[model samples]
Target: MLRVCSVFLLAISPLLSLPTGMQNVEGEVSAPILNEDGSLLIKSGHKSSADWESFSIAPGEHVIFEQASVNSSFLNRVIGNEGSELLGRLSSNGSIFLINPNGILIGPSAEI
Candidate 1:
């Protein structure tokens, strides 16, 4: 059934490719964790940052960010060819500076 296939994909997604739409190009940021609710959590260390190849958030998806401190910031640069589409929730405790020369689209339902 479709539901079974979806569950199987979710179970094996981590082994196939990056779970979230983030691929770090630099800095010492941990890999994105796919939460039980299908949300994405990213944790960065002290004075640390990261650059991404592609950064996007589809509808119904939530991306949460946690840094070393409230003053700490993580810089994410999108170097991929396509632009970014943010149509979901982006919750961050610290600061998240996203740099995408191509484009950055924040949908109406997006929450920062």
Candidate 2:
């Protein structure tokens, strides 16, 4: 199952939708861009974090992290009523902490 999912992601990683309702509630996070090409690119500075009303991604969509260094860490806290539906890619040089109290569905095509 895992192997199949991996193949699926590789086949479809360019189509997209991104996480919405994001706000920098605290820390040094900045300049999140959702490009027309369908990727969400976020630059994470040292000790940066953000909050989302909901956090999710669709197949082929990506949540990419750009940081000063690989040791940089960022937090994404979901405050919405619904659980996160992560069915896409989260490519990061650093660590990403996705916190959703409701629940998180990391789908078959997900690559984190």
Candidate 3:
């Protein structure tokens, strides 16, 4: 279960750059695809470029990325702007990486 705070603020960082092998896609990017066998995949345009797209989450919105099974050690990675408040419960055997140049707030209810 992923829950975002009602009054969350997304502060844009000018110095922050996209991760290697990832590119910024124009327009808004949607949530990742959740597989039936408990695996999640964030669609990319191509294997060489734009492997992971950037997206925004509105305030009070809940985004859930679920996987049917855990086959690998790395599951997901989330990159947000500074001063963003992320609140939710994450239960998965794989790993999750959150990257923010400025800072981020993880609520007490959040579970990895």
Best by lDDT: 2
Residue 91, candidate 2: C-alpha displacement in angstroms? 1.0
* CA displacement after TM-score superposition, residue 59 of candidate 3 (Å): 10
> Which has the greatest TM-score?
2
lDDT of candidate 3 over 55-111, digit per residue (tens): 223233333433333432222233443343454334433333445454556666544
- lDDT tens readout by residue for model 1, 15-103: 32222356665556888888898888898865555666677887677888887789777888777776778877888878888888989
lDDT of 2 by residue, 1-112 (tens): 9999999977754322577778986667766798787788988687778888878888778888887688888889988887788888989888889999999999998999
| Candidate 1 least-lDDT 10 residues | 12-21
lDDT at residue 2 of model 2 (Cα atoms): 100
Candidate lDDT values, in order: 0.75, 0.82, 0.36
Q: Which candidate, 2 or 3, would have the higher TM-score against the true structure?
A: 2
TM-score of 2: 0.80
| Steric clash count of candidate 3 | 7
Per-candidate clashes come to: 0, 0, 7
TM-score of 3: 0.36
Deviating ranges (above 4 Å) for candidate 1: 1-27
Pairs that clash in candidate 2:
none
